[model samples]
Target: MGGNLSAQDEPASKRVAAALRGRIEKGELAAGSKLPSEREIASEYEIARTTASAAIRLLEQEGLVLRQHGRGNFVRETSPLIRLGGDRYSRKYRGGPTPFRRECERAGLTPRVEVLAAEQARPPIEIAQRLGVDSFTESVLQRSNLYFADDEPVQVVNTYIPWAVAEGTPLVERKQTGKDGIYGRLEDCGHIMTTIREEVTARMPDHREREMLALPGGTPVLQVIHTSIDQNQSPFEVTRFVLRADRNGLLYQLAVD
Candidate 1:
């Protein structure tokens, strides 16, 4: 927050935050570097302590800084790697149905689902193929949205389940259970998902998505297709996840012989 009084720029507090952010971005401040105290900033900038404090709050909200109770604030490290993919429905984190929420929480991220629309509909061709069912068969159509840090829409997932399997189950019944995972809820309803296979591809964004994701013209989306199966070896669900690559980093480990 320390700067000259005649700092001919936007607002004084914004100028201060911008200067600090620039320093951090340029590695001058670096991650984990403690910011100057409020009094020091006020003295250096010839501004009031309140201005210095306000600058910190703004940076924190922008995800540019982290404030620890007694440790003061520092630039937040860039978004963490998102590790996904694992054994399906093994009760790895929770014994009940949904463990995905637990996994996300353990990674220090908030997860929520907004039901866009859910009802019985014939499976789309691609989804029908993945689910190993006839395209004309009625399936449970569900759309759930996902939000990430800064309230950005990182992923939009559309899922399909056969009504015969998900009907009357928590998977079909939308709930406000913030902590429950859909997989867990499905298990609770006796679906007992046992495995999943996934496919991934990347492509340029179409006009609709560019607007929905608020992306510039050139950014591409990472498309993931997943088919999950039950213990009976029957395909249970098909999910298509469209993720914003800039905000999400997919992690995978490779083993070579």
Candidate 2:
């Protein structure tokens, strides 16, 4: 079947994709529901079969549909929403469940963490500068972590700590930090946290990140650089968190001065 496209200036593929996307977002196409076949879509939309295929590809890139080699296209399941805010750093939450775990629990989702690495490593120039260490210093501890919500990878975190601060503590181990996270352990070491500084940016994920997070093409990620400061006004930790843009919402509660 064919139809005239003179009325709409947009490309045929885009129009078809838009229509299908709306259906998916409106829940007309439930998660895991199969999409119309290329032939069916082409006949229904009165577009070329190739154009219908391209439309499905577009939805795949947008992470709204998954196309298996033999199983045909299907609507993708939604991910849990994570809210990142200042309250996660409160002392009350520290040394209990990890902030990530707590957030997932609050959302009624299972939270899982895989400790990728925890070892002493040379810090990057930016991290070294933030920690007030010389460029040549080899005394930094790095902790790399992967967080999953409901078994879906959602975020990657890399935290750097000055060797002087983490040398004699569990921070140097690759084991769980118990109820208290790194911040709690630091508190036990006489470094009381006072403030946190965060810088947020967004960009498309690099190849490595895309593979690690199993992200779809055209999906962007949120990069958050966090600096933890102690009561002495000294920066004790620098953490880089890469969050799946589709799965997280950041909230900042600012005081009106």
Candidate 3:
């Protein structure tokens, strides 16, 4: 407890929270170790019991600690790390297991996909633009999926395909895309993808995203918008991927020809 105290201008709860967070980080309080009880913290820190409780609450909100019913708070477990690399999109990889399934297998975790919605709907203006369709004149097949690694939600994906291409395909069906995934199906439909473009950005999660991803307070999410184009220079699919910042690392490899 003899570490640097918070700035004088900081609130009492913040000061207490900082000290505990330092301890946790420094391994003074290891994972699964119980934190001081509110009464004990109040007595030791010479602060009101409510202030001590607030400090603990702050830690809980940060995902650094978890409170058990009738029991005190304990340090929470760290999440598994996942690397999303460019090689995952290779035709060879697609011919075998989906990238997500392969990654989870490598990490010894179960991978599961829950189809939230699969239907034909008018695309959002941005999606329509990416798909080379007029929002007013065309409808797109939209498929939303929630991906889990060992029961922990890690990503949300929304895929949009022009109705002309997906109207009679499995992309509009509420089921797994099988071993080859959507790209393989697209190829089967005579739309062989020759290029893919992805735009990535980061921001704080919205309320629904926070709940769906079970993110800690102050955690940021990564958004990736992907467009697949066929050899004919026509866009075939547009997908929006929402990933947990703390759990995934995105990697892109460029061949040095």
Candidate 4:
């Protein structure tokens, strides 16, 4: 039978996409399963190859499919979700695995982090404002890292600490920051970590981010601007995290008074 469509009123492209979308949602196609080629879909649907292509494009724009450069389109992978929450930063885990590692381990995935850069530098205007730095020319220690889960890139983290707070500290000399990650070192310098604030938003990824995350064209990145407050009610650290929307999730449980 040729073009055996369930509905004949809609455009040919949408009908084909709807049929395929049904299979995807029903688990008939399954995650990571390659979709039939446009030509194959056209043959099966008895529609023009261009119409078949348009159908596949619709699925891609909706994030239901991913097109590898050389390979074909496949359902997006949905397993091993790395979740972030307040518990990830618990002080009890300090002097050991970082938050990223702990979350990955909890999800039963291997974790890795690469320090892309660590140095003392002038802060951006927004970062300066967040840190309450008066002089933009004053230096702040910056640590840039790329986090991975099971060898797949997941997020980018850039941390900034005021020079007045970071100067003459272990944070200036070592990437590891000695123990307990940066919090332990900051506490050693007398900035007790007592509270945190995270502002989250979503936006389209730039070219560099797209390449770094190996994201498909229609994907967007989740931006989280994190601020750490100390016992003195001072914001000592500001971190900008760019996470892939597909591989990571957010969970927050707050107590309301």
Candidate 5:
């Protein structure tokens, strides 16, 4: 066929890439199968050899294919494992602006948190259970915040701590002067949170999150339910965080029993 392209007149490289992508997606080019040479593809598609090479390179970069030095390229047999909702997710930096700041930095994204409500308040039902307290317990301080990235509100988090542990710390005492990181501040008070449990799920954003995050209808939000325990194995904090679905990629690692 002639190079009539499309109304948008996409470049030859993209066109070739698209054609090859279609075949791979449709399973015509099965995973692990070697692709035809660039010269063969160019001849078949009536395009320049450079365009065919570009297509293969694009696929390699996208992790869809592997190019062996002497053996041309083969479709990737397996995709990269994107872990999600795992326990004890480790990061390079221990205490920082946020537990996830290091990961965001690695991905070339800026992460920030806006302290919304850091005052003392009764813990909600969800927070009580994880904190190992009675549902009606009013002896707690609630910390609610809106987390952002690159000016986008990505997560809304609500954390709770029993008053005894929070009363003497800046985490709850000086709500006006927001602490850098709640966990860090807790550690400063000689209560190091050595264990954390997190439960993650994806669901459509609720009205409050939709309005605050300016999320459009049908956009899903990842909900992370977490519980932090101090060195003595006592529950210290309970947190519920809602993260924008499109803004994050969760990693999970599992070990077979």
Candidate 6:
């Protein structure tokens, strides 16, 4: 990073971060480029190492830099795989790659999914309410999937189906129930999807999620909860998507009502 040594209206940390951020946007510091150490930045700007570290932290929070354990900080990957919102479930997109795989291929990246677990588990109180199950001890069939792009884990999707609906179907299988994906098997079981309700929130990840997604310390995750309703106005399926805030984005295209 090269810039004149001078004071600005902002604080020293913000000023340093802005300088580095500008170069990153201009491609002067290309993707995956290793950033200078905090000590180096401190020496250059005549600021404390803490200030330098704070500046780097700012960039990381903005999803412009990546912090890897045992390694140094670097520019974040430029290309991110985007979720096509509700359109991903369109029946027209069936018979080929799932929405996730298609997004990776469209970005010229390889996509892979690992079925982590398929078992009946008792739903949490929050989940139980959404599934309309008894929170006391009722169980729901859960299929957990870990999606990756270029071999890096990006998100974990956990889909829950009532045991009454998944008891004897492929829904209990570890692999995809069908090329059309879970919704098809859902429709087969008479749970025809009519409306989808999605809610997105952001919060720090738990230890398991942090380790699963290989996320850095202090990074947050986007939690997208989806509820699929049937023709009878009953919520049949609920999926919780934990997406890496740094590597993923959600795009929603809705009609102007």
Top TM-score model: 4
Write the residue-wise lDDT of candidate 3 on 42-103 in tens digits: 99999999999999989887878878879878987665546565677777675688888888
Q: Which of the predicted structures, 5 or 6, would earn the higher lDDT when compared with the native?
A: 6
Candidate 1 residue lDDT tens string, 1-257: 97666657577898888887788889987777788888888888788999999887778756567677788877665554264565433455564434445445656777655666666778888888877777876765564655444455566677787777677765655544333466655666666767777888987767766666665333568888888888889887888888766555565554477
TM-score against truth, every candidate: 0.60, 0.90, 0.86, 0.91, 0.61, 0.85
lDDT of 6 by residue, 1-257 (tens): 77675667578899999999999999998999999999998999899999999999999887788888689999987577888896887778767877888888878889988999888888877788998987776478989999999999999999988988988899898886766788878888999887889999999999999999998766789999999889999999899999998788889998887
Look at candidate 6 and tell me the lDDT of residue 2.
72
Q: Which model, 1 or 3, shows the larger TM-score?
A: 3
lDDT of 4 by residue, 125-193 (tens): 888888998645856888888888999999988999998888888787646665678888888889888
The global C-alpha lDDT for each of the candidates, from Candidate 1 onward, is: 0.68, 0.87, 0.86, 0.86, 0.73, 0.87
Q: Where is model 2 more than 4 Å wrong at Cα?
A: 1-7
Q: Return the clash pairs for model 2, or none.
A: 95-179, 95-180
Task: Compare the candidates by lDDT and give the number of the best one.
Answer: 6
RMSD in Å for all candidates: 9.6, 3.6, 3.8, 4.1, 12.0, 4.7
Q: Which portions of model 5 show Cα errors greater than 4 Å?
A: 1-92, 95-97, 173-180, 254-257
* lDDT agreement of model 5 with the native: 0.73
lDDT ranking of the models: 6, 2, 3, 4, 5, 1
lDDT of 2: 0.87
The window of 10 residues in a row where model 4 has the poorest summed lDDT is: 78-87
- C-alpha positional error of residue 33 in candidate 2 after TM-score superposition, expressed in Å: 3.2
Model 5: weakest 10-residue lDDT segment is 79-88
Please write out the lDDT profile of model 5 over residues 130-243, one tens digit for every residue: 787666757788888886766678778888888887886677653433334676677777777677788888888778898988763335778888888778998888888887
Better of 2 and 5 by TM-score: 2
Model 2 Cα lDDT, one tens digit per residue, 21-105: 9998898999989999999999999999999999999998887888877989888776556665778788877547878888898
